[model samples]
Target: MNRSVVKRVVIGKPLKTRELGDQKINKLKALAILSSDALSSVAYGTEQILIVLAGIGFLAYWYSIPIAVGILVLLTALILSYRQIIYAYPKGGGAYIVSKKNLGENAGLIAGGSLLVDYILTVAVSISAGTDAITSAFPGLHGYNVPIACLLVLFITILNLRGITESASVLAYPVYLFVLALIILLGKGLWDVLNGQVPESLHTPIGTAVPGISLFLLLKAFSSGCSALTGVEAISNAVPSFKEPSAKNAVRTLTMMGIILAVLFSGITFLAFWYGISPKAEETVVSQIASTVFGRNFFYYFIQVTTALILVLAANTGFAAFPLLAVNLATDKYMPRIFTIRGDRLGYSNGIVTLGAASILLIILFEGHTEMLIPLYAVGVFIPFTLSQSGMIRKWAKEKPSGWQLKLSVNLVGALITFTVLIILFTTKFPQVWPVFVFLPIIVIIFHKINAHYNDVANQLRIEGAYRREKLKGNIVILPVAGITKVVENSLAYAETVGDTVIAVYVAFDRESEKKMEEKWNAYRPDIRLVTLHSQYRSLIRPLRRFIDVIEEKGEEHRNSVTVIVPQFITKKSWHNILHNQSSLLLKAHLLYRRNVIVTTVPYHLKK
Candidate 1:
């Protein structure tokens, strides 16, 4: 099949530029697509807390309630701060744009690089967690988690490549399903407890109670649970993806997402405490809660299935936000310009593909183990949270818009809280997260290099004055050939039209072949001059390159320009072309950097 046909079938036909407006989604779909990450984090967030608390003893596990409350308060602060961001910078670069405009370019790059890394981890961690949910329900799939997580990444990447509206339509249901399933589980679990119908498993002894946990350990647990706040900034980053009145729509969606996330996170944590659930290697806290509340019946499976779907689909948030962030960086010349280009389906295909590939690499490296990837998660997330909030504080202070002091106070609280979380995460997660510290600076350096290169190229290409043309004294066309054939004849015919002088040069392995070529060329009645060069080591490119240098040196004497016409045979199939020697391509690449030399190809198509 033709490539275009394959692309059309895979991602649907290309949309007109005008259809970009049509691609904007309503708040409902935006909530599902953008909030999936924040919402799905509830699956693992409580477990992280429980695991930390469980480390000391089951008694410490109850500390999760206060920690959960702390996270909720922080989430509320972030929600309000990002809401202001959405309205203030409606074009929607989120942390990157806000940091750049208010804090400085370096701050922006750090914020951008941190978010980029976080988005990649979001996909990896979410998909791996999702796969964990799967294995929790069906133990048979445990060993296959890596492949499963990778396939989920690929599937979501394709969905986003199909376009925002289309992806939303497909992914929205599972998010809502997950929310509904969790609600049901919470409701039924609460009712059972209130009615004194608790499961027998709840009475089982966990361990001897330990009285104390260090402040550092408690902070570690708090930092781990902070994963719940991972995707809270995504709505602000993607305000433009909403329908008209995009900022308002994005703010509303952010509010809805905050409410849902708070309720689900708090409910799950509560049920885990009430049901005496702890994180098990084979099962998640959510899975334990569901099995306890609904038993291993239909409702139990429904909760597990929906949880798995939402966790996997939660990667959709990264898919939606990373590309838009990349476009912002590209617009500012910090990233490659290709990132600014939209795909046939009105999505940033390059960024989506890049994110998917990176996520797959991470999933494979961690072997789809969510716990291993989790330690690397919170640091990248909170760095941007702190920076974005800090940037917002600066913006409000400088501009002092209407109600600026209140906005400043809100963002100040957000910044201080997130920065405190960042310090805790760094101190606690140093062993696993140190690599992020190393990688963050490297990424920022790369951004600087790319921006510098673009700046240099723009300076070189910018035209400052009226056009001035240089007159060439002469034009010389040199045609390199392997043998005399129709391709050579056709190429020579065109070379004759281009310049008065056309030299057909051939590289021969032996004297006999050189004599035969010269005799054959004379017999063919070709008017062009044929220069025969012998290669002692049978190196074709070296000898040809030397001859081109000789010709270029002579041309310089006459102020002449040199053009090398390479004759290439076009095979009927692309695969067949690969079977033949690509010396012409190598030659063109070799001469591409010469200032006065031009290279061109004359292709003769094969019927076979």
Candidate 2:
């Protein structure tokens, strides 16, 4: 089997165009596929907030309560706003789509560029955080963590290449298992909290302050907790990926995801407060709380295992959305044409591999350190969040259909809150996140270049008025032959059908060879004129190029074009191809760029 066959076997068979509709997912799988990023963020969201609040003494827990509450409030508003977006554009109106429709092309492009960058960062940060969880559980394996993260990326990449349904099937169990473990942990812990079995240290206020619990610090802590809301919009962006009644299924899934995320976020925040768990360099806050609730037993390890599974698999969200978003960008001519091509499994195969490769680079560059990478994650996501919600407000104002006031109020609140978060994330993390700024301009410029190229191509190929099918105007076939072998005879025979006139050209290096060729032509009488040229420089390409250029100079006179037929000798054994000279291959390469020259390769296969 060849490379393509092997690829199909590895990635799954090529799905037909109509088979795409069959690939739409049910709600269970859609939740697992699209909600992984948001759900998994629960594993680290509280930890991010605690990192900032650690400075304010044991009051870190005190500060965390309000931040978690704020995040929940924002989560509700964003979900309500996005539900409107899902219904408004049931065919998946992501930020780029919404902004482009309501705002303008530049706004749309900016949103697209931001979302693209965010998708890449999502994979990298999720994998890195997941790997950190593993090392926190077993400190001895810490040195090899980056390589482990890269391998995990490759694993998820293959799963995604198998198509969304297959990936959802593989991932659904772990995501559901994680939710089960989390709720159980939360239920038991909450039951203990209410029953007064909680540790006394939680309420005992140790007034040790790490100095600055200022307003800036509180805002930063709130912004940090907002990371949990990162992947919430993915559901609204990918509404069409659901089964029939797609909008209803999608909105339901989005609501379910928000509820689950809110429950987990608040549960963990409450647990962290009761348990007085602070961020540890070696262990995560979730791991710490799990130990407090379950204590180094089978259930504790179960929580840890499932957390790692969901976190690493969180890249699945990027896998699902990136390809879909890439196809959208390609359709709009903002990305390369290749992104619009489907793979064997009918997933956005190219986009899958692209996200994987980019994440791997990030994992290596940052050494798989989760804390270092987390700061860069929020800005890209929030830009789209702000723009998309603001666009919805604009759209509602202009359209003002039924219930526009309610919709406008929800989106306005979401827009203001997200814009504030975006600014806070930028001002606080700009030192570490300068890369995001640098990367955005490059991405936006690339979008412009792609749009420009597509426009130029469209203008060149546009057929206005009526397309006149002109007859083949004045054609000539030129056969470049080495000797009078079977290959030459066959090439000459095929060249006869090329046009009205055929010329068999030969390059003679010496007088003896020229005389021998003329004598053979005379004896055989192939009934074709032979134009022989002398070669001073043993380079075969130079002579063929000169001949084609000479023909090109005969514009509109001796026929319009020259078609060069190059015969390729295919060996029975692939290894034997190196045994023959590649003169005709080189000849075709020389003639290919000439203005009215056409090059055709005719394979002449040898039978043993």
Candidate 3:
């Protein structure tokens, strides 16, 4: 009985007009995309401050307000600086392009590497934050954080796989509702405070003393709260994803995001201070403010639902930006080529899978604890922040500015401010954060070195001018054959085409089988000469090597142009077929290493 394997070929269809067409996202949708990260910050950014403050006690809740305000100032400066990025380089490379064009490839690689790590952390942090919020609503979910987190990651992956516009459209309304609910809650809290009806905090019974406010503590808190601004840079990377007048739309989106973040952050901080919202005593400042203003009734539940929805949607920011940034990095040859190829749906499939898996792992490692992840978070974000801003400074320095001298000065100040913030972040948080920061740069540097090595090896192996100019006038053709099959016939035919002095060579494992094969070859092709080499190891490679050495010693000039033909059978089923046991492919690979030895394969296809 004979078995035949069939290979299936797939044909690809072009994207339909709607799929390939640009997304006509209005101001709201664009705002939703840009603010997806910032709006979601309300869910955990305050919690992160509280977590840090909790270490000191409930009295430190007052510090959250000033910290939030500090974050707002930095966010405003960042937004203005990025507006320049949108105007100057509208392409999606964002920090990578800015760094590469100004500082050089090493700076670009550093920025790209930092941003890549930040995107992965964004996914992990968002998912962990969402998991905590969900567990708060359902206490039974305490131990199931990892499973639920992975499920959330899987769900987000599916949404992204559907396409970017589709995912944004799905999340738009819920994100909007989250913003409205937050505003309403903050407004009501302020109204109560204005009327001298400030409600007592539910968690005040925890009765904790605030830590003494030092410059270092304040800077640490400010850097932690700056987690709110982590995703603002995504807009610069996603400029091309916008519709017509891409740069204008990106700048508009950036402005809207900045305004929204500032208002929500400032209002929340005010309400937190006015009502004494404390995570040291209470888990979430938003929930505490919600319960205080709206009571523990339907409004509180509504706020909880919307808050959770927004946190989940915050992960959408990473979903949208990671793939785009990865594509840019891949294009620059700093990353694997797979990231550069888009899926059938025009999404970065590799980036999506990679981002989701990494985020889920981080969530599990942190036990879905946003606090534990926060220290690690700011390190990645600020590395890119300082590098990209430095790139912008270099860019302005190089350009001959005419009308925008003030703008250039603003960029310089912006770079200085961000650089200072980065220094503070590294110094204050590095004890807890440095381990993560150290590993990422090490991995990136290792990958860069590996790629460089691969390119160097490939360059050496490539045929050069001198090698190609040499003629193979007197080389002998050695055709290795086995049995009286089509593989042997094909090898013989090809060898004849190369030159007239062609000999069929074979290795005999034993004398009996050797005699049978030699008789068969003579019957099949009497015109062809046959030579057999005896092998003690039962391996073809050793015998072939010995045979070639013998031929070379006879005449060096003849050896310089020799061609080796090996008849190889092409099996339809890749797994089941074994032609030379363990040595066939290895033999061909070894032969390829030698100079002046040309190896040719004669494939024999089996009919069904």
Best by lDDT: 1
**All-Cα superposition RMSD per candidate:** 14.1, 14.0, 14.5
* 570-589: candidate 1 lDDT, tens digit per residue: 76556444334578888989
Residue 362 lDDT in model 3? Answer: 79
- Displacement of residue 547 (Cα, Å) in model 2 is 34
lDDT tens digits, residue span 1-608, model 3: 22211101111222332354443455567677557877788666776676676666666677776678677778877888889988899887788788888888777877777778777777777777777789878999788988888898888887776666777788888889888888788777778777878655533423345556567876777777777777888888888778878899889889988887888888876776656666644367788878879989988888899888777778888878888888887665566666755554566777888898888877777677756666666766777777777887777777856656666776777778778878887788777777765777686785576456435433433333221121223457888765555556566667777766677888885677788878876666667678988764345777788787666555465444677887766544453242123344666887887776777777765431
lDDT of 3 at 559: 41
Task: Point out the worst 10-residue segment of candidate 2 by lDDT.
Answer: 464-473
Report clash pairs, candidate 2.
none
Backbone clashes (count) for model 1? 0
Candidate 2: list runs displaced more than 4 Å: 199-201, 204-212, 465-608
Whole-model lDDT per candidate: 0.85, 0.81, 0.72
Task: Give the runs in model 3 whose Cα sits over 4 Å from its true position.
Answer: 1-19, 23-27, 50-63, 199-211, 457-608
lDDT computed for candidate 2: 0.81
Better of 1 and 2 by lDDT: 1
Question: For candidate 1, what's the RMSD?
Answer: 14.1
Ranking by TM-score: 2, 1, 3
Quote the lDDT for 451 in model 2: 76
